[model samples]
Target: MRLIIISGLSGSGKSVALNTLEDTGFDCIDNLPVDLLGAFGRHITELGEDAANQRYAVGIDARNQPEALARFPSILDGLRELGIHCEIVFLDADDQTLLTRFSETRRRHPLSDRDTSLSEAIQRERLLLEPLHERADLTVDTTRTTVHQLRDLVRERMVRAPFELSLSFESFGYKHGLPPDADFVFDARCLPNPHWEPELRQLTGRDEPVQAYLDQQPAIAEYFEQVRTFLANWIPSFQRENRSYLTVAIGCTGGQHRSVYLAERLGEHFRAERGPISIRHRELV
Candidate 1:
């Protein structure tokens, strides 16, 4: 059984993250009293090691009283002896993000009910878990992530080791903004503004009329041809380095027109040649 121990500070998104792991196929047990970890592993194996995909996620954190910290290492050791591949994932956030989230939601900090301020409690908690945080296989900072972005970051890790990295494409508007999680960003606004053409106003880059119109413009065609070449050249370097995921963003005046088309074309290029990719029109959606 591959046992994944999900532990971190009080408000680091562990509960939601564990839920994501469960959604992706892990047998997740939240706040499993930390003490029962050893027995659970042994029982799973005895019932036929291969019988039930022996994968589990356990959430234990600062919300528990202090003594639980002392018991953590020993429990992990017990799991190791049983031939279980145990790994810990630690989630964290900046003090500011934590404070903002709690304040916005009208929820008091878990350790703040003792008359201690949230900021003070956060500082104390960070210092206490310094050791465990160092040992974590993965550490995620949720200071500026949306729910979907956070889920993607966590979901990519949930795939088994040696998993194929996937490419993602998104389209954005210069006004509404670029995608924050993009690894590669392109300002397609420089190429052409399809919003100006009366006939092309309702069509996007994905539509034949818009694409044909853009194709007639030497600069637009030239730009995309170059971008395609660039991606083809660099993608395999990423593959050779074993990067798990890559995101490319295309932006125009409005996400509805040119950027949307280019993102679709880019997705087509990735599917045609690269191993795998997930494409999205961020603003269009």
Candidate 2:
């Protein structure tokens, strides 16, 4: 069986690296324990000589400061004894990049908790996993790479993977503010408010009737045209940039009227001119 092991220092791109294998139809096992590694291979090996078709991708990280998990080399040797083949894909960025990620998200490092400072824990964990990194079959540097870029790298390596690119377009009410992880954000509230009309109060933008009503507003139509042009320019650019997904959020008051209509239109336009598009109305439904 084709066994892919995604490993790296804590805060490296291990989670993202598995995307390629997952896309390629490998049965992915994330954050598997070190001791269970051999059993996994034994289970897969039982499938017989044709076991080559049955593949696995496992993710291992430094959770719980897994000092004991560093036995990966010995595990690899064990798997070697079993007549199994494996690839160790390691991901790493610089310490500074990881530190910035921690700062930007305001998230505690996995190696450390409230009990310890981030820098110390990161150092401690780095010292632990340094050896396995030296044996990596593939190493990716994610310091300058965006998430989409990282995802694209995985796709490029996984030749037999399926087409798993799912596009999600969302419409949200901006009054509450933008979604934290928006790939592309646009302000549709600048367009005319369809909420002023009592006739359109309950209808959502996904409905043809609501789209028809919003289209009657001349300014909204103009705004849609300009935004459509921008989207057309950006969608290809995003794909060329190797993004796995893009989220475009359109917003207006109540999210039931203008935002909804605009999001629906964007989804349609994107699907027609670009790749497959998945849409979500965050607030307007």
Candidate 3:
């Protein structure tokens, strides 16, 4: 049987993930106590082949006793010993984002008390959940994501068949910030700057004009080839290690031209060779 453990900070969209999994035909149980995990797995196992074939998603959170949470890793190890295919999907957002969500929704923080401030509760939650985070097979940062976007991402990336790695290529501007979920980051600032050319300044890498300009540069081609070669050589290792997702970020000074162009190129190249690949331009509308 396939088991997905959904755990995350309180406001990081764990409910959304569980709901998505439920919609995708997973037997989902929210706020399942950590101690019951093994018994639940065994119960499902006894349900026979048809029941075993149905995916199971259980939501776990910081609300569990600290001792139970700490024992989670061992519990998971035991599940694997029983021949269950288990994967953990951890969802997280920055403190500020969580705070904002609470404020906007007028919802009390789960870990907060009369004396503990919201920020303090958030910090405490993070500390308590560190062990689970460290052991997660996939960690998603939902700081800037909307409800719909988070749903889409979880559905696309986490609901796949076991051991299928979903690859994502993200383009971003270094001036903005690094993507928190990127497994590997490549700098493209040294490449030719399309922002310098008066005509190409306004055009993006996705444009034919910018593509034509970048295509003429030998350095751009060389960089693409090198990055492609590196990923080709190493991606199988990640898959063999049973990684469920890989995010590759390419960044330049501005995300408009060079980064966007290269990310699209890499995404296209890999999508043809690899099974599932997605591209996103962070700074682009």
Q: Which candidate is the best by lDDT?
A: 3
Angstrom error of the Cα, residue 55, model 1: value is: 6.2
Candidate 2 similarity to native, TM-score: 0.53
**Candidate 1 vs candidate 3: which has greater lDDT?**
3
Residue-wise C-alpha lDDT for candidate 2, range 1-285, written one tens digit per residue = 667778776666777777666776778989888778899988888888667667778987676245556677788888968877676667777788888888988877876877888888778876776656666655555665678766765665443322223355667777766654356677777776756767766677766777787778888879889888887777677656534445577778667778778788878887786556666565631
Model 3 gets an lDDT of 0.90
Clashes of 3: 0
As a whole number from 0 to 100, the lDDT of residue 258 in candidate 2 is 81
Residues 190-222, candidate 1, lDDT per residue (tens digit)? Answer: 877778899989777778888887778888778
Q: Rate the local accuracy (lDDT) of all candidates.
A: 0.74, 0.70, 0.90
Worst ten in a row by lDDT for model 1: 156-165
Of 2 and 3, the candidate ranking higher by lDDT: 3
Q: What does candidate 3's lDDT look like per residue over 1-285, in tens digits?
A: 789999999999999999999999998999999999999988888788877667899999999999999999899998888778888889999888999999999999888999999999999999888888989877888876778888878877877787688888989999988888789999999999989999989989899999999999999999999999999999999989977789999999978899999999999999899766778787876
Q: After superposition, which runs of candidate 3 have C-alpha atoms over 4 Å from their true positions?
A: none
RMSD of each: 6.2, 10.8, 1.7
lDDT of 3 at 109: 89
